[model samples]
Target: MMRFFTGLITVTLLLGGVGTVWLFLTPSGTNLRYLMADTLITTQHRSWAKYIIGQHAMETRVQAYQQQFNEMGEERDTHEIHPDSVPAQAPAAGTNHEAETALTEKKPLVEIEEISGHGYSGYVMTVNDPTKIRIGVPEKKGRGERVLSMAERTGAIAGVNGGGFADPNWQGNGFQPIGIVMSGGELFYDDLGKSKSTQVVGLDDNGKMVAGRYSLDELKALGVKEAVTFQPRIIVNGKGLIKDAADGWGIAPRTAMGQREDGAILFVVIDGRQPGHSIGANLYDVQQIMLEHGAVIAANLDGGSSTVLVKDGQVLNKPSTKSSEGRYLPSAFLVFEHPELAEIQNVWAGLKPGDIDPGKW
Candidate 1:
């Protein structure tokens, strides 16, 4: 009995030592500490994990990391001309002739290509005209809708998850979006008071991809057709915004959107968390992918478990969540055959923010 006990203890010690070594020596860009922290907080003993790692410390670290990357500066000439810089021009009273002509011309509406690099492999969806893109919101105010469901309901040929949602305790109802959600030129959700100057990703009436900081009124003035708000614009003007992998928002599953100079929208989704299959990708990897594909303007969308790409009623990428299908989200950018024909009703029309509880499913 004594001998057996000694052998068991020795084996346990050896395994623990090996695991610790692997975690530390894996790679320079790997976020082993974050992985451990996330795992602990997500498990049933979250209180214990918080006590061990100090929630405040973890949050401070995360903020510091994000701040470092955000301050790295944008690539020059990649951003749209400031609204104030443009001379005032008469607003067209009806349909834009130029936009209509561009839409009617023969061009590939959507194309998907496989993209790969040193540490990542994913797909880049090229949208010829940004006008065909539309934001799909959930029908119910307090409940979320799946991206696939939104795509099917809207008759979209392709769809990708959009924006961030209020995920309380990581078990949110997924009904509430964290920032603004504008579809069909109408504001459905706004949290500008809580967070000033959100980074918006959308399109103007002329099919121009609009990305940058904007207020609700500014969005209105810009004639934004479809928009959703999120953070940390990764590329501006054909240059990568993130400086390095360590500051690349802690490597994980990623979903980002960008636009080329030719008015083509780029959608990228990198699968993650499945160790042997796809560990994940950092913001730098995503930035590099965007640059290689000729993206002049690019920004990160709600990634992690919300990352998804669907085409023709089929999921294109492997979602990192246990659900496999992907999480129910508040919004998704759907591609339509006739975007002008899409009739999207405001789900949050009569409801106030207080009416919804993110903790409730």
Candidate 2:
């Protein structure tokens, strides 16, 4: 009996070793291994990914991804949206007067729907009038504010997280943004100089979604009303840029914004990291969702633990953070009944990056 038990344990160990070798060292498992590493890179445990792949290999992979994203941003968006045709639900030439009046009456400007993919579930919000969307920032001076707070303070009907920021050691106070931030046709914050360019995602004065790489001067020239810095325009000119799931930047909570030809804005907020519920989505998945909803242009926003959707001052999506309130974000795209009247003050108006302390409360 002792000899039999010893043999069984040895066989089990051998099989485990073989399985590990097949998973980590074989070409067939390259995607899976890289997916694991990429997912880790989004989290605070980025260094843990080096255990799966060697340190040098991990750095190479990350750099390659950065290059690919930069190349994607180089492609210019040549599409334009007509905001005048957005709410064209008017009655035809020959219709009853009462019915026509009813048709002319305003519909709900914002519509929220539940959306689910392979291993993720979240919400897709459709704002009929794109011009009403504005970027909301914290009113306080020292720290960032939550999406719910931003929406409530600005009297916005709905809101979602926006842009990347300087989050050092993943414990940042979310006070500092990474690149340029323009709100209400004013340059609110800019880390890049006048000549240096960065990838931007926002809407212009005509309600046209402006994305891809642009300098501060170019953004101002284009009349960008609400702008923030983020990555890789996934869908441009009515085509998906991400080829497949492998290049989809390894599934995590994703918040992306898009626009249809008719000038309706689409916001996709996906939940992730919850095992039994939602595991998250990659860029390809987000692109597919936007395309299916008739998006001609789309770009990713600040996601992961920061991804949250708020409507009427209520949290709508499941945030992956320890607190259900979601992370305090530097900026959020908010929808208002009259966005032009929404008073969004520039919290970082006179302050430079060195003036703000991300660790301070």
Candidate 3:
């Protein structure tokens, strides 16, 4: 009888040890129902063991779950975002050549300009499929095609008005744009007669660089693209080209940008040609800093004394010439306040509220 009692006690103790381990491994939920109702848990010692084991099991369960998840493939843990899809937050404008290249792949709503319908006589084309464009300067052929600095060309005379400033024998004041082309992931057309002169022939179909500017070869090495000269300027948008030079030069190498805010795109032309007290543009000028404006891309054209803004049949700004005779420009970008354009229906459009048209004075 004593031996039978000893065997029963041993069996009970063995069952209790195994029960504790099982409770430690198992979580309390619907899955644990059978284990909870098991006769073993009804005992005081068994119930106490469950509580102690459950505390320790919680930590193990978490670690096990983490380990299982980590065992999956790396592909399940990663995602990719395209640079083009997001508006780049850049420290400075035009600095991210690679990101800029990504943007160039997408067609812009507005392009720089196009050089079509250009007869030696000069004709008009549409900007962004809207707005009329007219070129009256450069005479449209041969050397006349290139832009000359106003002060550099004493022989520059105004073809529109036959004044001393209009003398063709002398190069005149005011900037003349050569050809407008898009390059470097940007939409602006370039002008040869501007403060800086550059020609960029970029990445071609051959998968190699073709031409470049600034010696950086940015256009060639990257996906920079271009277009022809159309109405790239504001008043110059649909105006005629007039060949003439102003006797004076106001500033040099200045730069500006057209910023879009609310519903208006304002042309922020900065004067950096020379010191505020002195004349002529230099580096570090507010507008000349170039990178601060974030101009995805930009081009500098003729400026200085010849920089004239004509509106309402009158000159709006001070003409740099010592004489009020606005330098005879071979080409003039004029803004018209009255007539509207046919392309966008009304045509005369500008940043300001007044309807505007581009013309040659």
| Candidate 2 TM-score to native | 0.93
Name the regions of candidate 1 deviating beyond 4 angstroms: 1-57, 69-107, 194-196
lDDT string for model 3 (54-109, tens) is 63554454355334322311111111112233343444575577876665554332
Instruction: Give the least accurate 10-residue stretch of model 3, judged by summed lDDT.
Output: 117-126
Q: What tens-digit string does per-residue lDDT give for candidate 1 at 141-223? A: 78888899898887888999999888877778789898799998888888778564667778888777777777777778778
lDDT of each: 0.77, 0.90, 0.28
TM per model? Answer: 0.79, 0.93, 0.28
Off by over 4 Å in 2: 1-8, 84-105
Q: Candidate 1 or 2, higher TM-score?
A: 2
For candidate 1, the clash count comes to: 2
What is the alpha-carbon lDDT for the whole of candidate 1? Answer: 0.77
